[model samples]
Target: MSRQTFLEPFNAKAMSYAEVARTFVPSTKFTQLAGAWNSVLVGPRGGGKTTLFKMLSVEGQEAWTGAAAEPYKQTVAYTGVYVPSDIAWGTMLESLIEAGQDETVGILFSEAAFVTHVLLSVAIGIDRHVALNPVLRLEPGAETATDEPTQADLERVIATIARLWKVQPVSLSPASLVDALRERLLNIKRDTRLRAKLKLTDTPTQEYLGIDMLESASQALQAFDAAYRRPHHRWCLLLDEFEVAPMHLQKTVLAAMRASGAQKLLLKVALAPCGPDLLYDQQGSAPPSQNNDVQQVQLWYADKTEAIEFCQQVFLSRSSIYPALAGKMPSEVFGTSAYAVVDDSEDAAQIDLFTLTGRNKKQVTEQFQALAEKDPTFQEFLRRKQIDVSRELGMQPSDRHGNTLRKIAPLVAFRNAYKGKSVGKKRGVKPFNTAYSGWESIAAISEGNPRWLIGLITRIMSNNDQVQFPVPTPQQTAGVQWNCQRYAEMLQSVANEQFGSIKTSTPIYDVLSKIGDYFHNRLVTATFVEDPPMSFVVDERVSDDVEHALRIAVNHGAIVCYQIAADVGGFPTLRGLRFRLTYLLAPVFKLPMRKSKSVSLSTILEAKPETPTSQDDPTANPAGQLIQGDLWAN
Candidate 1:
């Protein structure tokens, strides 16, 4: 399918298994489930965790059921449950009630009897209502039943359950009532089975309410599972938005499920990266050690290949679903393409389409060429449009476009065209250009942190039509500049928010500035060491600043810390955690340091002398030369 047609309804719904699987094949961590695992998958939001989980669950279900497919399938018994942490408590309560009814058998007679009695009353009431008036619906009202008791009459029957159990009045809470019901149901079982185990009497009244409730609830769910007939045999509890659950409750729920040894029951949870911290903080608990059973996995940026492939699959799936523009190039309309060209060389030909674009190069040159052909005058138009837009926006006319300006060109064009038509001075202050500008900058900076990328894109797209171009008056010009500056300021703001105060007295700023300078100076050929402690190098001019910033950054844990090696030629050179900061900072600030070591500044400043002299003084080196005729020649 063509790219343009495919993305027509992109991201409108959940993606298909094939499409998502194309983006991210299940990793070892995803596939390696030998037994029950208390796994916490963590990643930046929108980094495809949901997609991954969905794919895994579906695949697991398929494997368990031995469902027919073109290829042979594996048979396994696994139930996948997704419980968003937010509603975990209610779900747990519900599951408990279900389990209790299912597992109520011979041992716990009183608990089981209570559950049986409640079921019997409900059944008898329901049957009576059905027999008396077949079409009548059981609608509960405040008044007592005058004619036939409705299914709504079941409430009274359920409420009367307290008397049979010799218990306190049941609370109005649904969960509480469910708990109470489960407890009453379990009384018989507890009296018979648990009586001997706990050395107690086999009487419903003698059973502890809490234990009965818990045990009955567990058994009911088990029983329900055994009786149910479905192809996907196991039951799954999906927990969505898990971050909402209080930390203690999250732990409690997890602990309960773990203790149950309820095979064929799976717990799937969704939580933001911040969820863990919130859980820990609310519970006033220490962070779990690495060896702890509750494993946390963060959803981070995909390798370049994965991201590009994801983009491709998204475009393809959309195109297939939508018929219009079915055969055309997708990237042409979107200003980006997932299509890549292959060279004849074996090694080059073997490269995966996704990684080639992500790692080796971002520009789809052939696609760009095709787009250029679509609009023969596009390049010229873009240049002229940029100049006109820049003038209208009150930016200085310059031969070069800064990365920020170039990146936000589309936004500026759209905003400028929009503002040109609006006629009211009272239309409120023109939307800041930086609103869109900042997003593009962040994309370049973050290297496609999917959450941040999606967030920025969503934010800009929502305001795409609304952003206006104000006439460049003196005040408006200043406003535009202010907005531009503020866009840059966001990096610092976000950093500060995440890491706390970035004091000038600290070395972080110095290192950042130096790193910035280094990139500005050496626009190409920058490298970083990946091992701990990480360190970087650029031109010597910025070295001191970079060192200081590194120190501060390390101290604050802004980055994985590293140190520079003193010796350049030592084995395992550049030992430390190092990454090229140039990739991040170059688009923001263009530094002015010279890259060539051979070009000395002194040579450029020196003038030719009228006469030459051989200066062979004992103090002077033989290589030194002096001007003879004039001592101070200009």
Candidate 2:
């Protein structure tokens, strides 16, 4: 048999038994979330929010918990149900709010409309589960729920749903009942002609439907006996992509979870760090405290160490299921260094094309030396840079450039390597190579996102329809880069082009472009400035439109934020927070990807172009300080 390539069995989509167990690496946050049972899981897209939810879902997949949260298994207690976001379905809701309806009534009406939608999703999920698994226990003794549930079972489900509205039956089947409610919910959200139907049902005892409806649905899950593990069995709602849902819905859902009255129900929601929208309630009177009603857990990587461990663990776990690689370490199968980067260099990418196109250090150095000896043009440029450096240091230019060129040949060779030979004409040329490797580079390339990281690695292993053990070979790197680059480009496009009439895009694009330009030519290059503005800060008090724009930028991963008071040297003057254009856009600009240099928004807005002060008065502030004149003397 051939050597093993550690292939990942699961993507975001399908999963088999062995694949699930082999690829699962438990995280601390997931454990805490499972133990706490009610939480808001927040992070950027591909930060493993959806994957975590998928693993934790209670769909006859017990012990689905990862290793980190072990010994404390995600209890077979909660009947965990996954609810997908329907931003498509939210349009009608948005229209209603804009129709000049009373804000208070609109909020209430929207609550009913949204709650009904959640309930319907849950019912259909449960219905399908029981329908497919006929031998599974649904309730008391009925384990025979086939593709078609018995009318008696249907009656029970109907009664359970009736308890949700707290009213008489609607005489609809499980499918019909869901279809009926979905139609009305849509009507309430968008149909101006049916605008009168926005209010709570008059037949339901004049009761206004709220999250209690979801609570009732949670309680109803117990009817499927498989959902029950022991007494005090719990039910959880895994709310994914909570950020994209309307702002009010995010607040409303959290508040609803607080008032759910289903003490056993857990709230597992995913969120993004868009500050203002999450800072306060609808009344704007109070901010939601993290420790109080709902626990907030972030899934973003804090550092390279953690990111590498995660990536390594994932590789090992996925490899374990491969028959040929059953008990091998990741390093044994795939060497730790897939990337060829300079060690301890401030700029790793300063290497030559020979080093870039798939050559190890020894081979790259030999090639560079051969080129330097053969090519007069290569020698000339090296000598020119040498003379410049020699003059700067006031040193004699006898052999400094000559010595420098050979010692760090790759660094200088890149600018003129083409003069020596047609690189690919030599037969068997290697593809691109990066300067760094291991988890940090992988994490950097992934922009600290797990989904793309996982997908990229999976694609690498699956190259040539063979298990790509030892290494993915240079051919697979392009495919891997393509996916990462695609995600990065998507974020920029959203920030730039404003897909889907999202208004927040342009402001973010404008601010980032403005910041990028100023930094490249001004702040970073200015020699006399101390504590130069590194990133722009946005005050919380900014207009709602600006806040909305910033929220979109952050939520969509176009910008990464540093919370005021939380970060060292945080925005002292700005009441809100600061943001930097996400380094994920580094590839698009062909610039070295580095963390943003922070500057305050106030600084950017208030800045006046400096007028040069001549040597006549070198002490004058370039800002043109105002002179204080004595008014009494005048």
Candidate 3:
């Protein structure tokens, strides 16, 4: 298969149910989501939300085979019904609801239609489960039966559900039952539009709209369980890409899920990190509070330790498919990073002292002496920390606790060592001021995003006909930069589409451009300031336009948001938010792929915007050389 196939793995929605399950590598969040409770899975676009949801669905579970899936299969406590949505469907529904002659009538019709849609999914999920009965059984304590549903039993169950839902099926089988619900939903949509066109305020729904969908769906599930001889089974409604649904419909679903006491019902919803503000009621009732009502599961990993582990797990699981990659670990292909030594599947490698300091003890001492002479800050830092680079670099430390070498040595060394080094005059000959190599660096750039991690590795493999183990550092840097540049350009394109035409001094692109330059300046300044500011705290006094643009930047993954402070209850509040450029764009700005000191968003915005510096400007930066057109156009 083509290497391009590996890139497609990042898109879970595009894959078949079997492929999704087969390729999925279970993460820590899986345990949290597998519980028989309600949850809202929030993450960036390419994070593993859809993949997890799909794996929980009946089809994915059934298609799943082999030892890797055994533990997860055993965790199945409820039958999952996956309800997928898109922008087109959501916009259409929103328009239909808005066109209603009467607000109340429109809401009722939309609510009923939503319920019918869920029911159709539920029936199909149960039908698939029934087909596997008698032959395939789930882990112990699941709602599996020794015998499959007989024709009479199936007919009776279908009749019970149809009666409960106030619908009629032309035939009695489960497939027909699913068709019946589908038709009812379609009819409701049609009647709603017709009512709007005719300016009729009377209720448009032909069937009863007063029934509680949550309770009614629960009742239908029970009927199936009873007929199949698997009583008291629970069902989870898996709503994927939920942010696409109209605001009113989203609230309706949330309200229903919160209000209903249906013991058999569970809920799992997935949406973007900046999805529409969830409100159970426009009036006074409390919104669904995390921990109190639903578990808020975030798919992205910000912590470096956890991020690398997850990246390695995904690499191992997916790489096995290719014969050439069999039994190989990430370190073998990507090699060790210069910034930090990350634990790999193969035995951990020792950090190379020569890379950070010099070729020998005498050279290392002279390098540090030269840096301390030019930079007083480095002199003070060395004295304050009692760091003896000569001894530390040339020999083992007497006390490991006092040795900051493990952490600060590489960063400090790179800052001073690469000072004043010009970008090589020849294209592709002179190297970057800093290296973005090693598995650790790759993980940092991937930003705990599985799709990104996969894409970076795939691009590297594709660039080489047969990649050698422990691929060259320059090759890794090339792959990393190639992906980073593409991402930067993609973000710029999205910015143009979102805020380009808006008459503003700081379009989203400008904000990004300004911030990128500010960070780049910190990295290449004449003075060495260890732990330069990379993160930013948004000030409340910013203009509405600027604030909106920043929010868009976050939603598009141009920047990442961190909750620095929280309420007394430890929940995230608006005041607690912090923002930083995604590390995936680190190479573009020639900044370190690490989070450090934070400055205020207002600070960067308030600074007089200079033309982007030579090293950082996409117009001139080697990283941005591939970019065409005026990316920084006013």
Q: Of the candidates shown, which would achieve the greatest lDDT relative to the real structure? A: 3
Candidate 2, residue 217: the lDDT equals 63
Candidates sorted by TM-score, best first: 3, 2, 1
lDDT of candidates 1 onward, in order: 0.33, 0.49, 0.65
Those runs of model 1 whose alpha carbons end farther than 4 Å from true positions after fitting are 1-38, 50-81, 85-218, 229-233, 241-245, 253-262, 271-297, 319-634
Deviation (Å) of 23 in candidate 3: 1.7
Question: Mind giving the per-residue lDDT tens digits that candidate 3 earns over 536-589?
Answer: 666675675676566566656677765411111112223325667888877787
Better of 2 and 3 by TM-score: 3
Write candidate 1's Cα lDDT for 96-174 as tens digits: 3344432222223322343343333322322332343443354456454445434344334434443443444356222
Query: Candidate 1 — what's its lDDT?
Result: 0.33
lDDT of 2: 0.49
Please give, for residues 294-360, the per-residue lDDT of candidate 2 as tens digits.
5666665444345555766766666566686688765555444323222223222222212223245
Model 1 Cα RMSD, 1 decimal: 20.2
lDDT of 1 at 183: 60
RMSD of each: 20.2, 11.5, 8.3
